[model samples]
Target: METFTEASWYEKKENSIVKCTLCPHNCIIKPGKTGICLVRRNIEGILYAENYAVLSALHFDPVEKKPLYHFYPGQGVLSIGTFGCNLKCSFCQNSDISQNGIRDPERKALTDPQEIINEALDIKGNIGIAYTYNEPVIWFEYVRDVAKVAEKAGLKNVMVSNGFINETPGREMIEFTDAFNIDLKGFTEDFYKKHTSSSLEPVKETIKTIHKAGKHLEITNLVIPTLNDDPVVFEKMVEWIALETGENTVLHLSRYYPHFKVSLPPTEVKKLSGFYKIAKKYLKYVYLGNVADPAMGNNTLCPVCNSEVIVRNGYKTWTSGLDQQGKCKNCGLKIIEHI
Candidate 1:
C-alpha cells in the first residue's frame, strides 16, 4: 500500500511539482522522488510524508539514555522513533534506522497515542513519550497529536534530535514538549556541510527557539577526533553556547568512537578534558559521556556553591544537595530551574 502525505509546509514549484520547505535543505523533489529525509516525497504535484503513522521503533528507555540530565532525573521515558533523517551524519550511531529507506522486522507493532500513553503509565518511574531514534521534526504532526494526548494525561513529551528543523515547525512542536536534547554536531558551517550535509544556522535557531519557549534544553557535542576536536574550534563552540543560550544550560561533551563511514578514530580523554576546562569558563553545567574519565566530568556540581549537587554514579542520580524545589541546599542557590 502506498502512503499519502499531507504537507502544509511547502511551496508549489510548478504545475505538477512542489518544494518542501520543511528543513533548511529546501529539497525541490520531483514526482516520485523522495527528499533527503527519504520520508517526504513529491507525488504528482503533491508532496507527502511517507513515515507519517509508519512507526519503526518504540521502547521504554532511561531518560539518561536520552542524555537528558536535569529534567526528571533517573526516570524512564517511553522512547519512540520513525525513520529517515534531515542530516547525513557520517558518524551517525543510529544510521541503520535513520539513514535506511527499508524497514526492519525486529521492531514492535504500531500503536496509537492511547497505547503509547498506556505504556508510559505501565512503566516504573516513567515520565512520557520521546520522539527519538530518528528525526522527530519530520514527524511533527504525529508528535504534536501524541504530545497533546500525552500532555492531557499529565505525561511529559521529550525530543532527542539533531536540531536541523526550520523555525515554524520547531516552534509549533516545542509548545507541547517539556524538554529537548539537541545534537550541536559542530561549530562551523563547513563541518555541517562536509559531515552532515546540512547547515548549522537553522540548528542554532532551533536551539534558541527551545530556550526562548521556556522549555528545558540540553546540548550534545559529539567530539570527533581531529575532524572537529580542534581546541580553538571547541572553545568557540563553548563561547557561543554560553553567550547565546546562557551559563545554566547543560552541555554533554560526548566521546566519539569510529562509527558509520567516518572512521576518524576515537576521541582522546585528554582532549575531552581540555575541552571541558575551556567550556567551564563560559558554561556552568558540563558533563562528559561515552568515555571513562576520573568521574570528574560524570557528576553534576552546584555552580554557585562549588559543592557536589547531584552525585551521578553512572546513571544512578543521587539528589542529595538538591532541595524539594531544586535549589542548592548548601548556599540555597537556584541551580536548575526545573529540577
Candidate 2:
C-alpha cells in the first residue's frame, strides 16, 4: 500500500474526481475508480499510479526477443514489466499483466532500480535493461526514474512499447533510452480506435520523434489473422516507415495467436512470409517472428552486398558478419544499429 505514488500526467477535478491525461484516452476517473489501464486510481481527488515498482513479471531475455534486431544483436537484457496497459488490444500477448491491475498478491515482487541495475551488471554479457511484457508507458514515473538510473549506471535502456506516449514524456524517454521496438499497431486510425482504444497519429508522431533523437529504433506489427493483415494497409505502413523514419528501420512482422478476448486462430505462416517479403521493399532489415517453420526471415542480409550478415535460429545469433565498427564486413556499408 505504501508503494503507491501520485501519478504524473493527470489533473485533480471537481468533487474529488481526477482526470488522467497520460495517454490520448484522457480518462475521467471517479474517486476509488481506476482508469482503463487499471493501474491508476483516483482516490479523494488524487491520481495514484498503483503499479509503480510493483512488478508483475521479470526475466533476462535476448535483445532480439524485444524484437530489436538492429541494436546489440546477441546480447542479453534484463526484461521487466509492471501491470496495466493504456491500449486495450484484443490480441495482447502479455494480456495477463497488461489487462489487469497487478499480478496476484502472491506473485507480486518489489524491485528497485538499484537492484535491477546490480543484477544487470552482474551478468557477464548483459547489455542493459529492457522494459517489456506490458505497455511500459502507463508506468511512466517508474520507467522514467529507472531509465535515468540505468543511464547513469552505464546500462543501455530499451523500451518494447506500443508507441502511445505523448510528446513531453516521450521526449524525456529518448534522453536515456538507447533502443526501442515500437509497435505501430495498425496503419489506420480506425483500427487503433476500435481495436486498441488508442489513436494512430500520436504513435506515428512518437516514431518520428524517436528517430529524430538518433536512438536505435525498430518496429513490430502483430499480424492478426484478419484484423490488420490486409496487404494494402501493411504495404502502406512499410512505406511510411521508410519515408518518415528512414528506410533503415528494422521491422519485425510477428504472427498473431489467439489470446485474451480475441479467439481468432494463429496467423498462417505463409502470410507471415509474404509480408516479410513486402516489407523488404521499403526497409533495409525485416524479420518474421512468433513461429519457426522454414526459417527464412530470421537471418539478416546485408542491404548492399546481399550477404548474410547475422544468422539467427531461435535467439542463437551469429554476429561475425559485422565488423568492430558496426558495418558489413564484406561491403563496408555503415548501418545504423550499435552492433
Question: Model 1 clash pairs?
Answer: none
The digit string of per-residue lDDT tens for model 1 on 1-339 reads 244447767887776778888888888888888888887878887887667657777788878888998887767788988888888999998898889863843232543677778877888877889999888887776788789999999899999988887788778878889999999999999999999999999999999889988899999999998778888988998898988889889999999998889878788888888999999999989999997643769777888778888877776777788898888889998776665
Considering every candidate listed, which one attains the maximal TM-score? 2
The runs of at least 3 residues in candidate 1 whose Cα sits more than 4 Å from the true structure, single-residue gaps closed, are: 2-5, 104-108
* 1-339 per-residue lDDT for model 2 (tens digits): 555789988988789988888877789999999998899998888898888878777788998889888888888999898888998887788888888777653444544678778877888888888989988989888888888888888889999999887788778877778999999888999999889988999999999999999888989899998899999999999999999998888898888888988999999999988998899889988888888553578888888899888889898898888898888899998763586
lDDT per prediction? 0.84, 0.86
The candidate scoring highest on lDDT is 2
What's the residue-level lDDT of 46 in candidate 2? Answer: 89
**TM, every model:** 0.94, 0.96
Q: With candidate 2 superimposed using the best TM-score fit, by how many Å does residue 210's alpha carbon deviate from the native?
A: 0.5
